[model samples]
Every structure is written in structure tokens, then in C-alpha cells.
Target: MLAIDFQHVTKRFPGVVALNDVSFNVRKGEFHSICGENGAGKSTLMKILSGVLTDYEGDFFVNGTKTGFTGTRDAESVGISIIHQELNLVEELSVAANIFLGRELRHSFFLNEAAMFAESQTLFDQLECEIHPRQNVSELRVGDQQLVEIAKALSLKSDILIMDEPTSALTETEVERLFRVIEMLRNEGVTILYISHKMEEVFRLSDRITILRDGQHVKTLNREETTPQEVTHLMVGREIELIRLGKGRQATEPVLEVSNLSLLWPGHARGWKLKDVSFTLRKGEVVGIAGLMGAGRTELLECIFGASEDLPEGRILLNGEVVNFRHPSEAKEAGIAMVTEDRKRLGLFQQMSVRENITICTLPDSVSTGIVHSRTEAAAAKKSIDELGVKTATAETAITSLSGGNQQKCIIARWLRTQPEVLLLDDPTRGVDVGAKAELYQVIDNLCKDGLAIIVTSSELPELITLCDRILVLCEGHLTGELAKKDFSEERIMELATKLAD
Candidate 1:
């Protein structure tokens, strides 16, 4: 029996056709995985299936019966649940409240808070999680929050569950727990539809996989009949050759240096976020920071860029001159720029046009006599779009209308306009697709060859290995080890990253 059957589904937005006659099916009691590049209509198709999108050209069958779900509640009424990639929980509410939101138990006109907490505790027990039901969602870490999302879906008693990039923010141990929960669900005859960019996870858990490209259905293949290489090729419709640095740059003079850097952590158990850390960067050199989730990678970059919540205790040197910047604008004035990891939240101006976002930080350059020049701004935006190969209809298009990769390129272009000698990238390829990742790698390489110094942090070790001349490993706010390119290995990096500080 089929769990879902989507026939000739088409969805359109103002400036783009998101999905064009996409058709696919999921079998009952099977793990079905979907593979695609960014902006390939994977999320749009999922939205349609989960009833988050109602206006579309399609006929869908649920449990062998044709149905048109008007809203998310309508889909939930028929044993369907979805966990979005971006978390959807209220920070001020308790875990149990988020889990039972809008479906509160009642005792003759009074809220049954105890009953809801009990049920939420039971669900957490089933998932083998130690999260307390009454704890505020804000106090929990991102991985725990993801578990709450899973628990919320499980509470619905849905036979069909859809997970979109559920492991994006999870730790390795948390991922193991999630996999066990998935196994339990499958054994109970629940159908799973999973979406992720990680090839290993898709291959390991999926019984069958469907590939999509440019908002069109490409092919569906059984797990044993296909490989990751084939799926990647189908996802981008081309082979991607990532550019790699052959050797370390042999520059002599130091361009940037940090000495005795320490950031205090207030109102937390950990006394410090970073402790007496030091590093140096040279012209034409790329340094990579390797660490686990709370190893102070992002915090270190924030300290250098003058964006940290608290001023750090450190001495930063630029071109052999001691520099202390109190704000990010001052750092930009000193020829330093940073590209943030959280693209949507930190980097993008969603309501503005592509041209406006590209030139927002450098408006002074396009101004004369205290008046902004529209032609100058447009010319700068055009240069960035053309140089970065941003795929957009026009410079006036909305910034949010582009794909994740293109949006990221615009962010980089914004920083490039600052004409900085030092660049800091925090997980530059976090949610980007394979083809765009290759292109970004080439761009970084080219920039380094042109005498730009860079410091990058990434969760994925392979990416750092491919781009960095030297890798510095951090653990518990301490610098554990540093490895040259020749000594680079995942095992070694992981060892240092997990080491506990004294």
C-alpha cells in the first residue's frame, strides 16, 4: 500500500516556478529519502504534502483516498506531521507547553497542566531523552530543542512523519538517539519521509531515495541499486570538482595577531568562553579553526570582529599596530570583515532587494555630499552579482527570492565591498548545496592567492582540510592543538577537539 501519492504537482511564486509537475510516491511502512540541491523545490513539495501550502496544481492521495488538505490542521487530522528545518518552538514556553500547544488537556474548563506534563514526560521517556517537561525551552540547547520537535511530532500519533534536516543542529550522540527513535517508529509500521544533504545518513536509513533537480522529479532508486556519487550528480545535473589548496602559503610578515585572548562568561557555569588563546595570520594565508559545538569557535571570531556580547580581554594587532575596536563598524574601518554562519538570521536583510542588501554596509562609498547615488549603488550591486555568478532575474529582485547558496554569495559580496585585508568566515558552507560549495571553494582560493588573509571555522572537518593551510583545534574554551596541512586527519582533529581542558 502507498502512504502518499503526489501527481503532477506544480507550485509557483511571484518571480519563479518553485515546482513544475513534480510527481512522486512513498510506500507504507518504508523510509523514503528525498535528495536535491538548494532551491530545487524539495521544501516546496514537502510543504504541499504537509498542508502548509494550499494553492497548487496537484492531486494527492493519502492512504489510497484522494484529499485536499486546506491547512496544517487538516493534514494533522489525517495522521500527518512535519518537523521543519528551522525550529518552531516558543522560547518563553515550557517544553511540555510547546509539545501540547493548541491541544491542551482540559478538566471541565480548566487547563490540565499536570496531565500535559505527564504525557510529555512519557514521550521523552520513549525517546530516551533526559529533558524535563517543565523546563523552559530557552534554557535547553539547540540539540535538545530538536529533540523536543521530534517529541512533539511523536505526540501526534501520526503514521506518516516528515523530517526536514532534523540533524542539522544535533550532536553525534543526539543523532544516535534520533536514529534509534526512527528505528522504533519503523518497527511500529510508521512511514518516514526524510530530507537531508548528508549522503551517508540518507543511504543508511532510507529504503528508497527520490532525486529532484530544478524543481522537477529526476529519478527514484532503491538503496542497493544506487551510490552517493550518482545521487550527487543527479542532484546538480553535473560533476563538482572542489578546488583545494596544494600547499601552505609561504608569506613572511604577519598581518593579524591575537595574544592572551580571553572572554569571560557571566551567569553561566563555565567561567570563561575563551581562555588565553593566541593565533597569528599572514598575508595570503588561510587558517582553519576546528572544534565541537561549544568550543568557542564563533565566540573567537566575534571577539576579533567586535561583535561579542562582552568585550574580551585581549590584545589584537593589525600590521604590527595594537588595535582595540569597540564596535563592528570600527573593525570594518580597520579593514576587517566577517561572514556569519546563520545566514537567514544574521546575514540577510529579507525585506530588501538584492541590490540593497549587497550595498547596505558600504553605502558611504556610493554617497557624495551627504546624498546616496542610486547609479553608483546599482553599479556596485551589478559587479558583485556578475563576479559571484549569482543566479537572479535582476538586481531589483527580493533577496529572499534567491537560493541559499546565492544568498550566501551576496553576503560575501557585501563584505568584499569593504576592501578588507582580513576575512573571517564562520561555517561558510553550512547549508549550501554541493555545486555551490565547489564554486565557493574556488572563490576562496582565488581570494587567498590575491594576498587576503582568512580565518574560517567549520563543523565539517573535510571542508577545513580542503581549504586551510593550518588547522587549530579547540576544546572547552582552550586551544588544544594545531596541525599543519601535512598532519591533517579527521582522527587527529577529533582527538584534540574532544580533549577536556584542565
Candidate 2:
């Protein structure tokens, strides 16, 4: 059965044509995906399908019934539900309340709290998820909250589910759980429309793929018949920068030494986020941490930044002197800076102007007589923007107005305020365009030339090969092995990644 059909659909934003006469069809019970770059109209098309955007320019059909969805409720009325890249949960509500918010069980013309909890609990059990329906939504981890979103969408009894970048924030275990749920939905005759930039996950999850470029339709292919390289070419329209094992080598002394670092998850039952992970970083060198999702790459950086917790066991040493940080401020004071994995959520305050966001972190350096020197701040902002080559009408523009790449450059500017001796970055180029990614590589290289020890975590193995002096492989919270620059290759990293317990 055909679940959805969009014929010559077009979406437009101010000064940008988001989707240009896009058309595609989705089959019932099949896992279908849309692939594109960040600004390629993938999100805009999903919004149109979910009825978040209504002023589109073409035909819309659901389940072979020609109709136009005016709003989200109308889309839902036709057995359709959507989970956005950034979830839309009410943080104050309980898990049960978020799931059955609009359609609640009533008692004598009043609310029925007990009935809601009971019903939500039943759904959780049916899905084999361990989330508590009574728990506040704010308390759940990102992975668990994503599961809650999926469960909530399923609770609507919808035959078609639209998921946008669902695995972008998920750990490997959480992704497996989601894959299981998706399989169950497919088996029960539900259609899925997935949107993502991560080609690996898309290939792993989708039955067929529909490629979109600049809001126009590209091509659709069977999952088995297509290859990642071929899919990547179709999405980007060219061969991307593969892992570059640099010709130059750095042999400087150790600038950052992490000894037996370990931190607790506090919520998980079995183990900690990092299990005694130890590594060394040297000035003029870049060390890359390679792992699957949830292999503790982000957690390791968080521990180093003092953003999560104190290293109860491990000691971080700069210039061979033991340093401990109980908070992010202390870490920043110690000349240690970390760029978070999720740039939108953790890195930037979208409402703030680019100038303010860039210079906010460097006030101490840009202050005069205890008051901020606006001139110095502006100069610093301009300098970084010019050096980073970020595209914007003006530095006074809102951070949200720029594309994903430019927004990332702004975050990079914020960190540059603290002239750090060591820099830790997590997936720095996840959503940026190719041109921006190249610019960031140059920025990183310049920093390395300035003798700053750098450590970064990335799932793109090709990136690791190109960007690092060495690559460390982590598997299930264990540091499996290290690959020197000369020995760095995708095949070797894959070997260490999959090497399990004897």
C-alpha cells in the first residue's frame, strides 16, 4: 500500500528556496529515507509531510487519498506521527503525560491520571522499554528521551512514522533499541520516513533511499543494491575529502597526560561512561578517538572539561603537574577547553547575536577597568570571523540566522577566547557543508602549528585518518588499541573496533 505521495511539492523560505518541486512516494510497511546535506531541504520536506509547513506548492496524498494536511493535528488524524531532530517534549510533564497529552483518558469530565499511567506503562512493556511513565521528562538522559519520543509517536496508533535524525544523539545501545522498535513497526505494517545526514545509520536502517539535493528530487535506490560511496557521491555530487594521512609528523613532548581516567554514569546499572581510559596528548600533534556511537568518546571529553564530573580515579596532568577540575570554570581557568558534540544544544545560545556569542567567553581578556571594552570585543569577533571565513551579513546578526557550518564557526570563536594549551573537540564537522569542513581543518592545523595539544573524537573514520597524528580505538568503554599516523587506515580501525572479549 502506498503511504504517502508528494507530487511537485515546493517549499520556500525568505531568500532561500528550501524544496524545489520535490516529489516522492513511500510504501506502507517499508523503511524509507531521505538523504541530503544540511541545507538540502530534507527538514523542510519532512515539515511539509508532518503539516508543520502548510503553504507548499503542490499535491499531497496520504494512503492514496488525495488531501491537504493543514496542520499537525490533520496529519495525525490520518495515522501519521513525526519525531523531530530536536524533540518536542514538554520538559515539565511526566513521560505518560507527554505520550497521551492531547488524547487523554477522562473520568467524569475530569482528568484520569491513574488511567494514563497504567496505559503508558502497558505501552512501554509492549515495546520492552524500561522507562517509567511517572518519571519527569526533564530527568531522562538524551538516549532515553529519544525512546520516549518514539514510544509517544507509536502510542498514537499511527501507521506512518516520520523520524528526523533520530540517531544523531543516540548511543550504540540506544540505536540498537530503536532499530528493534523500527523492525517491530515494519513487521506490523507501519511505514517509516527517516531523515538523516549520517549515511551509515541510513544504510543500516532504511529499506530504500530517496536522495534530495537543494530541495529537488535526486534518485531512490534499494538498500542492498546501493553502496555508501555511491550514496555519498549522489548526496554531495563529488568525492568528499577522504582521510588524509599527513606527510608531516610531530614528535613534541607530552602536553596533556590523562592517567587512569574513570567517571560514573550514575544512572546506568552496569558500569561507568569511561572505564579507566588513559591516553597522552602532545603539543603540535592531533590524536583522534575512534569509536561507535556511545563508546564514551563524548563522555571522555566531558570528563576532561569538568562539564560532567571530577575524575574520581584518573589524574589529568599539564606539563607533568597533576590538575583537577571540579567544574567547567575551573577547567577553563586551567587553559583546557572542550567543544561539545551537539553544537546546537550545548555550544551556542541561538537567540544571542553572533558578536555577543563570540566575545562572551573572552570578557576577561577584552575588559577594561572591570568593564567590558566593546571595541576590543568587536575587533576580536571580527578577527575570528575573518580567519574562520564564516558567512554572515554582519557580526550583529543572530546566531540562528546562519547555516549549520557558520553557526559552528561561531562556537569555535567562543572557544578561541580562552587561549587553551589543550583542545578537545567532539564531532566538530558533523553537519557542516564540505567547504566549511575544509576551512575548519585549516583552523585546526593552524592551532596545531601554534603548539596546542589537540584531541578529538569522530565516527567518520576517513576524518580520523586525515586529521590526526594518531588514532585511538575504543570499544564498549575500553581503549582497544592505538594506530600511529603511518599505520592509520580505515580497515585497521575497523579491526580494533570490532575486536571483542575472548
Candidate 3:
């Protein structure tokens, strides 16, 4: 039986056709995986099915009944529940409150707080997670918050669940727990529609996979009959060459050095977030920071960029001179640039145009007598767009209108205009697609060859191995190991990442 049947679907945004004549079907009680690059209409089609979008040219049937959903409640009424990629929980509320936000339990005219809490606890128990029902959502870690999302979906008793990059923020242990929950749901005859970029998870769980590209349906293949390589090729509509980094360059003069860097963490079991961490980057060198979540990889980069909340107790030397940067502006002024990990929150100005975002940092170069030169700014943005291969209709388009990969390219181009001596990238390819990742890797390699020093942090050890000349592993606020490119291995990095310092 077909749980979902979408035929001749077409969705258009203001300046782009998001979905173009896409048609697909999902069997009831089966695990279906959706594969696509960024802006490939995978999410768009799902959004239409879930009623996040209502005005689209298509015919959609749910459980053999043709339906036109007006809103999320309409979809939910028909046993459709979607867990968005960006978390939608209210941080100020308790976990129980977030779970029953719109569908609160009531006792005659009063709210049934105790009943809701009990139900939430039962949901958490089912997921095998330890999140307290009464705990504030803000106090919980990201992985726990993701579990709460799952629990919320489970609470709805929806037979059809759509998970959009549900494990993007989860830890390895949390992922295992989630997979077990999925298995339980499958046993209960629930249908699952999962969207993810990770090939391993998709292949392991999906009974069938559907590939989409450029807002169109490409192919649907049974898991047993297809391979990851074939799916990737279909999604991109071309064979993606493996990322091959150039030969490592000889280390020249030191560009940046840090000694005994430490940041105090108050009211925690650990007294410090980083303890006496030190490293050095020479000209034309790329150093990778490898660590698990909370291993201080991001903190290390924040300290170097002068963006950390707590002042670090240590010394930083740039170009053989002691430099103390109180703010990120100071670091930028001193020939250092950083691309942050959280792109939505930290990197792009969502309200601004692509041209403005590209030239915001280097506006001075496009200004004369306190008047901003529009033509010069546009030219500079255009140049960066072309150089970075940003696929955008125009420089004046809104930054948020672009795909994840293009928005990232604009951010990278923004920093490159500064022409810094050192660049800091914290998981530059966190949510980017495979094709864009290859392009970004080549861009990074080209920059390194041009004598730019860089320090990068990534959750994927394979990514680090492919890009870095040396990898520095951190565990519990301490530098546990450093491996040369020849010595790089995922097992070695994981060992050092989990090791505790005495």
C-alpha cells in the first residue's frame, strides 16, 4: 500500500523553481530515504506533504485518499508529523512543555501539569534517553534536545513520521539510541521518511532510497539493488571525483603561536574549558583540530579569534610579536580571519543581500569620503561570487535565498577579501553537500598554496585527514595527541579524542 503519492508536483519561490514536476511514492510501513544535494527540492517536497507549504501545483494522496492540507494541523490530523532540521523547541520551556506545546493535556478548565509530565517521562523512557521531563530545554545538550524532538513526534502517535536531518546534532551514542527507537517503530508498522546527507546511516536503515537533483526526481532504487556511489552520481547528475589534496608544502616562518592558553569554566565539574593548550601555525600550513563534542575544538578556535566569552589566560604571538586581541575586530585587523561553525547564527546576515554580506567586512575599500560606492561594492561581490562559483541569480539576491553551499561560499568570500595571513575554519562543511564539499576543499587547497596559514576543526576525521598536514587531537580540555599526515587514522584520532588527561 502507498502511504504517500505525489504526482507532477511543482513548487516555486519568488526567484526560483524549487520543485519541478517531481513525482514519487512511499510504501506504507517502510523506511524510505531521500537523497539530494542542497536546494535540490528534497525538503521542498516533504514540506508540501507536511503542509508547511500549501500552494503548490500537484496532486497528493495520503493513505489512498486525495487530500489538500491547509496547515500542519491538517497533515497531523492525517497521521503526518515532521521533525524539522532546525530545532523548533522553545528553550525557556521545560521538556514536557515543548513536547505538548500545542496539544496540552487539560483537566476540565485547568492545565494537567502532572499528567503531561508523566506522559513526557514515559516518552523519554521509550526512547531510552535520560532527559528529565521537567528540565528546561535550554539546560540540555544539543543531542538531548534532538531526543526530545523524537519523543515529541512519538507522542503524537503519528504512523507517518518525517525526519529532516534528525541526527545532525546528535552524538554517536545518541544516534544508536535513535536507531533502536526507529527499529521499535518499524516493528509497530510505522512509516518513516528520513532525509540525511550521511550515506552510511541512509544505507543502513533505508529499505528504499529516492534520489532528487535540481528540484526534480531522478530515480528510486531498492537498497539491495543499488550502491552509494550510484546514488551519489544520480543526485549530482555527474561523477564526483574524489578529493585529492596537493603535496604538503615545506613549513616556513611561524605566522601564529599560542602558549598555555586556558579558559575558566565556572560552576562546572571541570574548572576549565581549555587548559594550557598551545599550538603553532607556519606560513602555507593547514593544521586540523580533532575532537569529540565538548573536547574544546571550537573553544580553541574561539580563543584564537578573540570571540570567546571568557578571557583566555595565555599569550598569543603573531608574526614574532605578542598580540592580545580583546575582540574579533582586533584579530581581523591583525591579519586573521575566521569562518564560524554555526552558519545561520554566526556567519550570514540573513536579512541582507548577497552583495552586502560579501562586502560588509571590507566596506572601507568601497567607500570614499564616508560615502559607500555602490558600483565598487557590487563589482567586488561579483568578483567573489565568480571566483567561489556561487550559484546565484544576482549579487543583489537575498543571502538566505541561496543554498547552504552558496551561502557558505559567500561567507568564505567575505573573509577572503580581508587577505588575512591566517584563516580559522570550524567545520566548514558541516551541512554542505558532496559536490559543494569537493569544490570547497579545492578552494582551501588553492588558498594554502598561496601561502595562507589555516587552522580547521572538524567532527569528521576523514575530512581532517584529507585536508590537514597535521592533526591535533584534544580530549577534556587538553591536547592529547598530534599526528603527522602519514600517521593520520580515524582510530588514532578517536582514541586521543576520548582519552582523559591525568
Candidate 4:
């Protein structure tokens, strides 16, 4: 019998039809994957099934019986649980408390703290990770927090599980461990509904794959009968060519240089967050930083951009002039701009308009006689929107109205308006789709051709191999190895990324 059945499911929002007549069925004890581009109704469909959106028009069946869930609690009451893409854990609570929240063990009307901690530890052991249950959720890194979420979902002991981009923040070792746990669960008859933008994960774990685009169902095919290329084509309705930017163009003289850079970690045993890191970036070159999670990739970028809270003991040079920037504004004035890793949390102004988001960085250029000129700001925004190919109904529209890919493009546009000689990007394509990723690659290539020096970091090794002229590998706050374009390989990069610091 089918474990899940959706008949004529349709969902509509204030200005969008999120899903239209979507129908699919998952056989019991099977791993089903749903693949689609950003803003393709994949999340909406899952939300409806998981009871986050109860007003949708649809008929759902669980194990041959008709079911309609009023909320997530109702879904959880009947063996359904989901791990959201954006984490839903309370920051102030301990890991154990967050895991067993609202369902804590009780003994004689008192909370059973010992039992909950022991159970949380068991779940962590099952996943083959070491995380103390008493640690505050906010104290852990993003990757570790992601593992906690996985453990919480496992704690439910649900028969049907929904995982939405569960591995987006995980490291290679963590992902491998997760796959082992998934396999064990499948063996125990737990059906999984997986959603992800990574084609590799989708192809690796799926028994059947469903494609959705623009609020409509496309097709469902057995995994053995499909290819990643075919599935990507269905997702975006086009062929996406891999980007290769390190062609015949030669790099010019050094535009930015760092020497003997080190950041001290206060109140920690390993005193440095970055250790004696040194590199030279030339104009018309894209240098990629390759590292595993907690290897200090983002911290390195933050140090260079003057956004790090702890000052580093280092020397930075811009065009042969020694400079020290105590703040990001100083770094910006010195022709350096950065796009942070978490766009939604750190980069974007969620409540602002697209035009305002793009033009806020350069308001001085759009002011006349101590007054902001609306026409000047709009003109500049229009130029960036055109150059970056940002898809929006109008420049005055809220930035949140756009898709993830387009919202990212807007952030890049904001930095481009500064006309910096050096650009720092932290995981620029984290949650973007294939089509938007290709577009972003093109944009980066064009910027390099125009003599802009760029430093980029990504968790995906293939992305660095394809786009960078050189790759620097960091492991545990130290520079482990550096590979030229000619020496690029996933194996070599991984070796360096996992090597111990000397």
C-alpha cells in the first residue's frame, strides 16, 4: 500500500498560486525525492503535506486512510515529522531541552531531565557524533546545530519523515554519517520524503524522483531510469552548461596582499581562529578558499572585511599601501566589499524595497544639496537590475518578493554599485538553483574580465575547481595547501581540507 497519496492538491497565497493540482504517491518504505529550482513550489507542496498550510485545497491519505492535518502537531500525532531547511530550534535552550520540547518526560508531575539528556545522547550516538546535550543551541556552529535538528527529528521515532535540505549546512563527514543513519532507518521501514537542490544527494538516495515547476507537477520517474542531467532539465526546462572561467586570460599585478595574518580566539584553548594566513590576489583573477566546516573560511573573509569582532594581528596592503581598517565602513572606503554567507540573516534588509536595498550602499552618489534624490537612486537601481538580470516586477517591490537566486543577485548588485577593486564572496551559491548558479558564474566571469580581483569561498569542491584560477585549502585555522588551476581535483582538495595543522 502507498504510504502517502496527494490528490488534486492546490495552494494559493495573496499574489501567487504556490501549487496547482499536484498529485503523487509514495510507496511504503521507499525513499522519495522531490527536485525543483528555487521558487518552484517544492517547499509549498511539502508545507501543505506537513500541515504548515492547512487552508490548501487537497485530499491527503496516509496508509490508505483519508487524513487532513490541522497543524504540525496534528501531523506529528500520526507519525509524520519534518526537518525544516531553516532551523526551528530555540536559541536560548539547551540541546536536550530543545529536542524534547513540549514532549518532555515526566515523573510524578516533575520534568524528567535525566531521562531526556540520556535519550538525546543516545540519538547523537546513533548518528556517530559527539555533542553534549547540555550545550546551549546558540553556542554551537551552524553545522552542529543542523545535527541537533536531525537528532530531534530522529527522537520523534516517526514512521514517515520529511527532510527539507537537511544537509545544506553539513560537512562531508557529517553528510556521510547522515546517509548511514538514513540507510538504517530505511531498513527499519521509515519512509522518507527528501527535498534538496543538490542533484548529487537527490540522485544518491532516491528510489523515485518527482519534478515540480512553477506550481505544477511535471513527472515522476524511477531513479534507475533517470539521469541527473535529465532531472535538471525537467527542473529548469533547459540544459545548464557547467561554468569554466579560468581560460586564457592572464592575471595582472597584485591588488591586495595579506601577510602573517592571525586572529586570537579569546577564552579558548586553541588561541587562534586564523593562523598566519598569507595570500596575494591579482587583478583579473578569482581565488577560491576551500575548507571544511569550522576550518575558518568565513572567519578569514570576515577578518579581511573588518567585520570580525576580535581584531587580528596581521598586515594588509592595498595597492602597495599599508592600511588597518577597524570597521567595515573603513574597508569599504578602501575599495573592498564583501557579500556574507548568510544572505537572509546578514546581508539583506527584509523589509526594504529592492531599489532601496541596492542603492543604500551608495547613497552619497544619489544625494543633492543634503537631500536624497529619488530619481537618481531609481536610475542607479535600474542599471544594477539590468546588469545583473534581477527578476522583479518593479524596483519598488519588496526584496522578499523575489526568489532566493534573485535576492542573491540583488545583494551582489548592492556590492557592485560600490565599484570595489576587490570583492569577497562567502558561499555565493549556497541555496541557489542550477539556472541562477550559471547566471552568477557568468557575472563573476565578467567582473574578472573587467579587472576586478575576487576571493570566493564555497563548500562545493567542484564549484571551486570550475571557477577559480587558484585554490587555497584551510584546515583547523591554518593554511594547509594551495593548488593551482592545473592541479585542481576533488581528492587533492579534500586531502588538504582534512589535513591536521602543523
The prediction achieving the highest lDDT against the true structure is 4
CA-lDDT, candidates in order: 0.88, 0.80, 0.88, 0.89
lDDT tens per residue, model 4, 1-502:
8999989999876566778999999999999999888778887788777888899887989999999988999999999988876667888999999999989998899999999999999999998888999999877766788899999999999999999888877777888999999999999999999988888998899999999988799999999999999999999898888666766557999999999899998887888889999999999999999998889998898888999888889899999998778899999999999998767667899999999999999989999999999999999999999988787778998897676667889999999999999999998887777777888898898899889999999888888888899999999889999899899999999999989768
Tens-place lDDT per residue, model 1, 1-502, is: 9999989999998878889998889999999999888888887888898899999998889999998988999999999999877667988999999999988889999999999999999998887778999999977656578789989999998999999888766645567778999998999999999988888889999999999898899999999999999999999998876465644456567999999899999986989999999989998988999887778888899999999879999899999999888899889999999998767667999999999999999999999999999999999999999988787878999998787668989999999988899999988876677777787888888888888999998877888999988999999799999899899999999899999756
Instruction: Please give the lDDT score at residue 476 for candidate 2.
Output: 68
Over 1-502, each residue of candidate 2 has an lDDT whose tens digit, in order, gives 7888889998766556778988889887899988876667787888888888889899878889987878999999988889876567888999999999888889999989999999889877766667899999887655567778878888888888999877665645456677887888888888999987767778888889999876789999999999888887888787777534344546589988888887776767756777778888999888999886657777788877887744556788888888777788888888888888767667889789889888888877888788888888889999988988776667887887566667888888789778998898988876665546766887887788778888988767777787898898887677889898789888888788777423
Which number leads on TM-score?
4
TM-score of each: 0.91, 0.80, 0.93, 0.93
Candidate 3 structure quality by residue, lDDT tens digits, 24-60: 8999999999999888987788889999999999898
Residue ranges of candidate 2 with Cα displaced over 4 Å? 27-29, 55-59, 64-66, 105-130, 204-208, 219-227, 262-277, 289-297, 309-314, 363-397, 401-406, 429-450, 458-502
Give the winner by TM-score: 1 or 2: 1
Clashing pairs in 2: 244-466
Give the lDDT of residue 317 in candidate 4: 91
Candidate 3 lowest-lDDT run of ten: 167-176
